[model samples]
Target: MKANKLTTAIGEITTQGYTVIDDFLQPAQLKSVKALLARINGQFLGRNNFEGGKTERIYSLLAYDKVIQDIVEDARIMAICEAFLEDNFLLTTSQSICIHPGETPQPWHADDVFYSIPRPRPMVGLSTVIAIDDFSAENGGTEIVPGSHLWSDEKIGGDYREGDNERDSAFAERMASQSIALEMPAGACVVFAGNTLHRGGENKSNGPRQALSNQYCQPWARTIENFFLSVPRELVREMSPKLHSLLGYSVLSPFMGQVSGSHPLKTLEPGYLPPVSRLKPPC
Candidate 1:
């Protein structure tokens, strides 16, 4: 992306809570992603309503294909994450979401709801959703509340999750009235502040709507996906240094993410073991 466009997109996010990148993926990349999803996406249904029982998600996608790795490290998306988060921010979640027909609209909430920090503050994270299929009003395009990222905790109220209670009907309607169902071609992407209010829309169309979602958070924050456990060490060694950093191999400074008193990357060395693992049992 051109510097001017990048600046403009960041401005939109600052003012409205989200921005769309109309050409984030090429045709070839789109086809490859669809193929990957076809083989893996529907392997399991969401376990709960919050996960959308009617939907399917293939988490840990980066382990399956290089294309996913490419998407996660895309410079354009990284630039946006850089604009919002601090140095050494880590990838929080990487997965594919497929909303099947009859799936209800998800309860409106912010992705950063996990942090328990007051809103109206700088977003602790950033999110990106790339359309894997054409998003339409009738299908399950995401619906976002413009400028909701800046709403205070008092404004969010008790109706929202983070408490896990059912969303209040009146609050749902109010947000519905404010939301815009995101509609874009398959290759486009939308990047938003983690504090923004949004939800998956109901799928009235005959077919399912699919998308790829990646989220990044401040280095000190806990990630939704534990890449260290989910992705094998061998695979991490195969990935690029940028990915190594994103996967928690890098630290926030002198101490965080250290392994056995050294940088986490040291663990990747062949035959390396944690110092504790090498200790003999008390004899």
Candidate 2:
């Protein structure tokens, strides 16, 4: 990635809370993912109401489909996430989002609202929604409220749950007026701060819309998905060290995320024992 591109991505997330980049994936890359998605389509459909009655979702994608590894761990996107969430951030969730025809819009809500942190802190999460199929307003593209990331908690006026689509009539109308559907070509990516208010758009078209979300969060926060258990340990060991760390193999300083007083990765190595250094307190 060029320095200018990194700067621009970070700047967009900083000022507008989001940025859209086309051609994030090569044609070959997109083709592989599309095929994989097709193979497993509808197996995980209608699991949750927030996912729209007509829509379907597939979780633990990295575990099932290896083709997405490069896209999920792309250095360019990681650069933006690292800057936004600071050092030691971790990939929190990765899933396929398939919105079928007649699915309604999800509620307006921020991803980090569950953290319970006081507002005005530097970013705690970052995300990218990668389009597997071209996103169109008629086909359930994502909807986002520009600049909503900068709004104070008080301005939001109340509590929110997942899939809210702005439950308060007044608030919903006000937010809906400003929301814009994300229309982009397949393989495009929309990077955004988790604080930004957004949702999946309604799908009026006859076909389904496909996309994938790769989410990152502050290291100290609990991940939305339990990657440790979901992704097998044997497979995790085969990933790069950076991925090991991102998957939470590395400890969070003074013993956070430790497995028997050592890095979690050790468990994957047969006959491995906890090193004495890890047993000793930090000096």
Candidate 3:
């Protein structure tokens, strides 16, 4: 993206809490992703209620699919993450979200609740929702309340629920009323601040709505998905240096993400064994 466009998109995220970019992936790229998902169909896990009982979710997608790996490292998305989350952020999670028909709307809430800081603070994380299929109102497009990121914890009110997801019914309804469903063509992406109030819409259409959800967080925070365990060391070594670093390979200064006292990337070296006896301390 050009500097002007990038600046505009960041402005939207700052003011509206989200922004959409169309044609993020070419048709050929989307087709390849479809083929990959089809090939790995059985590995998808089924979840209930909060996640939509009929929905099928697949985690560790980057390891099983190269297309997703590329998407995660897309410059446009990374720009937004770095702008909001600082340069030293972590790739927290990446998953395939398929909302099957008959699925109900997820309760409205903010993604930032997972972090320790209270709301209205500077963005600690960011999320990108990539549409694998046309995101229509009937097929469960994401619904978001514009500018809700500016809302304080007191404004949201009531006690935070389990999963750090559910908001009070009345509060959610008010937020939902102001919300707009992000309907976009298959290949578009909606990038939003972690504090933005949003949810997956109900799927009244006959088919399932598929999407890819990628999240990034401050480097010091624990990632929602444990990529180190999910993507094996051999596969991790195969990823680009940028992606590897996003997976927390580089330390966050003095001691974080160290392996036997050195940076975690050393563990991916061909001859680096795990035994502490052969380890080298940090300089």
> Which candidate tops TM-score?
1
Worst 10 residues of 2 by lDDT: 158-167
Please give the lDDT score for candidate 2.
0.82
lDDT ranking of the models: 1, 3, 2
Off by over 4 Å in 1: 162-167
The superposed Cα distance between candidate 1 and the true structure at residue 112, in angstroms, equals 0.4
Q: On residues 157-226, what C-alpha lDDT tens digit does candidate 2 reach at each position?
A: 6444545544577877777788899999999999999999888888999988999998889889998889
Steric clash pairs (candidate 1):
none
Residue-level lDDT of model 3, residues 1-283, one tens digit each, is: 8899899999999998899999799798899988887776655445645666777888878888778889999998888777877555898888888888998788676776777687678777899999999999899999998988998888767544353244366766676688999999999999999889888998999988999898899888888899988889889988998899899998787777788777788888888887765668879
**Residue 143 in model 2: shift from native, Å?**
0.7
Q: Which lDDT value does model 2 have at 38?
A: 92
Clash number by candidate, in order: 0, 3, 0
Residue 63 Cα positional deviation in candidate 2, in Å, after optimal superposition: 0.9
* Every model's TM-score: 0.97, 0.92, 0.92
User: Which regions of candidate 2 deviate over 4 angstroms?
Assistant: 271-283
